[model samples]
Target: MTDNISAYKFDWPPITVEGYKKAENKVIMVFNLDVRTPAKVDHVIQYVVGRTVWCSLNSPVNVNILLSFDFRGQGIIVTKTQSLKSELLRLLNKANINNQVSIDFLI
Candidate 1:
């Protein structure tokens, strides 16, 4: 870390999804959960988390992903966007996420 590159030292996502949109790339999400059902959460995390990170790490360049999470700890509110295309949602058709826990994507 050097002071020569101040602007270069910035947060990923760049305050928006602009980079991903401009680069024409997709995003991957990684979350550490503290919910009621540990087994179910572990199943989803193991299956899908870090998938995009693995892809980007081995690629030429311009491949990127936003590493984000939703914390549903004690007395916390879950407000994941209704529009998010969750990996667990797509793959875990029979998981019954709604009933498994109180987690949800708010509209």
Candidate 2:
């Protein structure tokens, strides 16, 4: 599991939900940064373990997802925020992400 995370090229910056909404368009999925190595990816996933969730006034409406990781593996991991919507949340939980990290929903 630790090997699956990614590290940022620069210092890990805080991704504010407010800032994401203001900056991006209607699309909610954004890969803010990418990692070039597996070790770096593991570092990122490990760092996200304790990160808190931020939401806007939209609540269960609009969502912003940030998938900051290194593409070391093959298939899609679905790290972005919007993909974790209520419906997707249930699916992920069923897929066994409940013990992974605290998921956040943005408005």
Candidate 3:
């Protein structure tokens, strides 16, 4: 095993992913409407919880979350290269959930 130790030395981006699927029957929703450092950190947990809920809705199939900051309220954007983009768009429209959803934090 010592011979393979060097394999772990490669430089990797700090990017990390945390969440799971099918933890609950209902889908949850949360997000950071803003990209600022302070705001992003402030709401990350709930936002991710919401994301997990969203992803888990498609259980039995593996799903990933792709989040980014948008200057415009463009809602969630799945990778363009993925075939699921169109399907997700239809789902959002059918639900009548607008591009911008509000986030409320309670003390």
- TM per candidate: 0.29, 0.28, 0.25
Residue-level lDDT for 5 in candidate 1:
24
Where's the lowest-lDDT run of ten residues in candidate 3? 1-10
Whole-model lDDT values for every prediction: 0.36, 0.36, 0.35
Q: Considering only N, C-alpha and C atoms within 3 Å, which residue pairs clash in candidate 2?
A: 5-41, 5-42, 6-40, 6-41, 6-42, 6-44, 7-40, 65-81
Ten-residue region with minimum lDDT total, candidate 1? 98-107
lDDT of 1 by residue, 1-107 (tens): 11122222223342322224345454444454553454645443443323332434434355445544455444334433222235444333233222111123312
- In angstroms, the error of model 3 at 21 is 19
What's the lDDT for residue 94 in model 1? Answer: 31
All-Cα superposition RMSD per candidate: 15.6, 10.2, 14.4
Q: lDDT, candidate 2, residue 68? A: 36
Over 1-107, each residue of candidate 2 has an lDDT whose tens digit, in order, gives 53332331224444444234455432232333343455654443444432322222222344444433323443434553343233334433443432222234222
- Residue-level lDDT of model 3, residues 1-107, one tens digit each, is 12222322334333233333355322223333553343443354334333433444443343433333332443333342132223333434444443332222211
**Who wins the TM-score comparison?**
1
Ranking by TM-score: 1, 2, 3
Please identify model 1 stretches exceeding 4 Å from their true place.
1-20, 24-36, 58-62, 67-76, 79-107
Off by over 4 Å in 2: 1-15, 18-31, 52-107
